[model samples]
Target: SLVPLLKGLKPKWRDSLYYHYFEFPSYHMVAKHFGIRTSRYKLIRFYQFDEWEFYDLEQDPDELSNRYGDPKHAKTIAGLKRQLDGLRTAYKDNSDVRAMPIEWRKKYRPGRE
Candidate 1:
């Protein structure tokens, strides 16, 4: 299923791909990891450990360094976070819904962005 779809995907037709997976039967902490990727950058967020990572794909294709929490990328991190949040919201993601203040979400929930 995935192979056929992915092989036929046009390079310009998409902006990013986000992936999430959870382990069952053998592990409980696996739910904490997920990744987001764009042509230019990739970021992985690990919730349980509060660990987040960033990579400038163009500059470091091999992914030898971890740029998370780096001051130079704070703006990038903020921007990507907004995008990730938007994607989650669109899919009716409610994992973090309770963590948001009702009034705050109402102010910027939709077209406001």
Candidate 2:
């Protein structure tokens, strides 16, 4: 269902290696195959100015909880990080945008100074 929907949403042509590999079913497919139902996909998110968050998709579909720094969900966070890392490696995505220097953002957002 969502697999076909996601595949259909993909662009016909992806010019970048990373983008191209994303076309192949991976994490999303694996999750779907396992029937890991969540109210929303990509529910765990980190914002530029805010911390990470996690949603009890079955309850709070809107993801209003900041479970990032919560000690209770340490295992969940670690597991998710491991899963994300595995997916990245499986896809051969080596980009370190998250590890980029803070100064780099200043270059793009000159007004932030």
Q: Model 1, range 1-113, lDDT digits (tens) per residue?
A: 46656898644456877765445224453434567789998887654334577999999999889897689989987888887877767766555322234464345333422
Q: Which run of 10 residues does model 1 get worst, by summed lDDT?
A: 96-105
**Per-model TM-score on C-alpha atoms:** 0.61, 0.44
The alpha-carbon root-mean-square deviation between model 2 and the true structure, to one decimal in Å, is: 12.6
Which tens-of-lDDT digit does each residue in 1-113 have in candidate 2?
A: 46765777754542212111122135443111111122232224222212245545555566576455768767766666565555557777664324224574355435653
Instruction: Give all candidates' CA lDDT scores.
Output: 0.67, 0.42
Q: Give the worst 10-residue stretch by lDDT in candidate 2.
A: 30-39
lDDT of 2 at 10: 55
RMSD per candidate (Å) reads 10.5, 12.6
Error of 1 at 63 (Å): 2.1
